[model samples]
Target: MIPIYFCHRELLGLLFKSQIVLTDPSEPPLKTVHKFMQKQLTSNVSKPLSSDVIIKSNTGIFFVETTEKLEPSPLAVCAVESASQTYPDRTIYFFMKGLTKNMTITKSSFYKAIPLLSSMENVNILPLDLEEVVQDTPLYPWYQKVNPAKEQYWKHVSSDGFRLAVIWKYGGIYMDTDIVSLKPVQEINFLAVQDYQIVNSAILGFQKHHQFLWDCMEDFVKNYRGGIWGHQGPGLVTRMIERHCGMTVFKGTEDIICRDFSILNTQRFYPVPYQTWERYFQVWNPKDSFNNSYALHLWNFMNKNNKRVIIGSNSVVENLFMKRCPRTYELIIKHASRK
Candidate 1:
């Protein structure tokens, strides 16, 4: 859930550079909207904020910033956007925007302030910068020794090409060249990062709703010097993650390749592993496609066609991605006509 005041353009400015999180509804940080969130929480819920907003739930999209006190005020909430005000179906809430600034209050204060919106366990206000919201994210320390550089340029290039192709054709998250289908999904309106093994910091979830995905992207672009873990794009994020002392404590079961990224059931493209499907995982043998494994990475590529990666069904690969991307197909036909 997002706080109301953070939406104000100027206050919101305070947020982009500040850290935030997607909290479980159970441990909500604020009890009531600070006079800041109260006065600032605009009725103006705009079009789904940038997927970059990050924290997500089945209900709605928002970016939250919390304060300690709930100084009272009665500022009428402003409309977020024209589209939002016009749509009756969308119920985007901007809670607690009328409270005072920088005051330290607790979840209990919020109930006294609003006297509405039933509270739950995670009902306390969430802190935008959780200097103490610590968690243990895990990883394999073996990668610490590798020198970061442009090793597999062609494969990376090809993957980029494929990514753009899918984005131009398919309208959701592009599966990394390595990912395979896991389970059948209904329909996802937003683009989510693709990975069952690791966070694709590469493949992104794009939805008008999520601004956090883009936030991660922007943060990577700004900070990444192409470190060993984050070679170019995703590596930047992972590298930052690598620096944190708390990272090693969480679940390290996921690989860095493709983790938690959802596999859409649109049947857009049926991708296989970089090797024979049967020979995908080296250390582990996964059973389910989407759950256990959705991709097989052909990591550590060199200029060696002699070192063959049995992409099992080459003809099948050709047949699978046979249809021209609609936009590209139209362009090609138009270009040919001109020629």
Candidate 2:
């Protein structure tokens, strides 16, 4: 379902023995997979744990930072809605339902938790009407509903609704939890990166009145167009937008002026003007004063050279943000560092 991207360095091999096994025959296969993963992840592998399961949980609210700019504002600064729940920590044991115990060194990473990374911010988990949202969005290749005529009416809508939901709930400048923060975010919506590559959602920003953003989301979701448009889906949206005719409205219009992004979905076909796809990684070698930037968007393959990291307790992105905001960073890091 969802991916859980977290830091896991100190407890690498140790997590294996703490894993859970599913043998319930009544549950669906996907259900079993979810349970197995949940236990392995949220099972609190800590030693001699307490009575409950949760360590920490909070829901940040989103409010308007400034009344002037609403179309595209910093989603987080806009305090909307946020809350969380958790139980005490405890340890448990189980048996393998499939393979033998010798299957050690498994690739048990947090794919589902990665997206929740952005949720760390006081994001408003609004009770949005799933049906309404699904209907307002555009049509994309990935929009699929097995029972089209019956239970999945909103399946046709594009990711615009999802994008809008994120902006409205969590703000644009959202950070994927898996991303290790490196520096202090000087300002909100600082356009650090160039206007290309679908404005990496891993670290993005916009104003509150950024209806243009909604428009962009609408265009991407409804128009079924995207060059590097992720979040709603992978590079699927990004791929479809390329099959367009020539001259198509000064491609940079959206990049430089219009924020819809859909107006210029051809980064692979063009240059990103002056944006450097660096800094959004584990190592940055720019000895010179690093300016004209806000935050790094470790979209994928956190390491620049794609180095095979051991996936430790603190991800590269987490370390980065804490380096910037010590108090805020440490609070989250120190708490998450628990067993």
Candidate 3:
């Protein structure tokens, strides 16, 4: 007899199979597998939130400052531009520790071609001046250790620390530069999950002085792993959720409520998996693509070098670029055509 709490028919079947082990101990460890499956469904039953304002005061949309010179990439431009358009009422902040030299143009045609981002009235580009923003926070020590290097390790580390510090001080939502907002987000405190197990820190929200974020920053210092790429990013987020929420498996669903925070389904932000990152650039099913998603994570950090948003391409990314950051799109096509 399966427990009534296991209402999902599929889960009920799995639990029923696990009972076989009690009769025949030689059988597979179906009970362990059932527990694993249950944990994996953590997000499956998530209650989707509506587009209603939850927190009245700390309502801001934020993006990490990019070191690329000239303008940000079309995707980066779209990330901020779309957010501004989607949530006109919310203040947007673009924070960076420092600017890149030649912060005007990159040798590459597709990268850093959008100049319109600098002029958005709602978007404030602020320097991550440690003394002013993070000097007294728990994350300041990690910030001090963030010396720039030729390797990409420091960028991730600094970003992890900077985002935590800023949000802790001033509550708001923080998005990666690659994410394109498709609609206004309503949840005031939430985290996005990318897979069945890992919670991505790419898109995060919280009120000022959220304890979960402080815990995450403390974990970052205690378990700082500069060599491990995701140690401070997704890895730290996942571990923090476990430590604070007592969660083991994330089903990448929308209804997961831990204390006052919510866990968003991967479909909400990352409809396309990383393994199939090209789908964002390919128009497979226009009607079905991102139908219910509020934003799209183009995985630009992983695909920026190879992917180019052609002017007239009917791909999903090109479409998003044309619609969300039309000015930048026009500039890129115009320049590329002239050459």
Leading candidate by lDDT:
3
Pairs with backbone N, CA or C atoms under 3 Å apart (clashes), candidate 3: 43-253, 46-255, 46-256, 47-255, 69-103, 70-103, 70-104
Evaluated at residue 50, the lDDT of candidate 3 is: 19
At residue 229, give the lDDT of candidate 2: 30
Off by over 4 Å in 1: 1-171, 182-198, 227-229, 239-278, 281-291, 298-339
Candidate 3 regions exceeding 4 Å error are: 1-57, 66-70, 97-115, 150-152
**Model 1, TM vs. native:** 0.29
Models 1 onward score TM values of 0.29, 0.35, 0.75
The true-versus-predicted C-alpha distance at residue 212 of model 2, in Å, is 1.3
Question: Which whole-number lDDT from 0 to 100 does residue 319 have in model 2?
Answer: 40
lDDT of 2 by residue, 53-145 (tens): 211111111221111121211112111111111101211111111222222211233222112322333222111223322333342233443
Using lDDT, rank the candidates from best to worst: 3, 2, 1
Per-residue accuracy of model 3 over 188-229 as CA lDDT, tens digit each: 899988888889988899998899888888898889887888
Q: Each model's C-alpha lDDT?
A: 0.28, 0.29, 0.65
Error of 3 at 73 (Å): 1.8
Indicate whether candidate 1 or candidate 2 has the larger lDDT.
Answer: 2
Writing each residue's lDDT as its tens digit, candidate 1 over 42-159 gives 3323322332232223322121222233431111111111112222233222323233333333433433222222121112122232211111111112123223254334234323
Candidates 2 and 3: which is better by TM-score?
3
Mark the 10 consecutive residues where model 1 has the least summed lDDT. Answer: 131-140
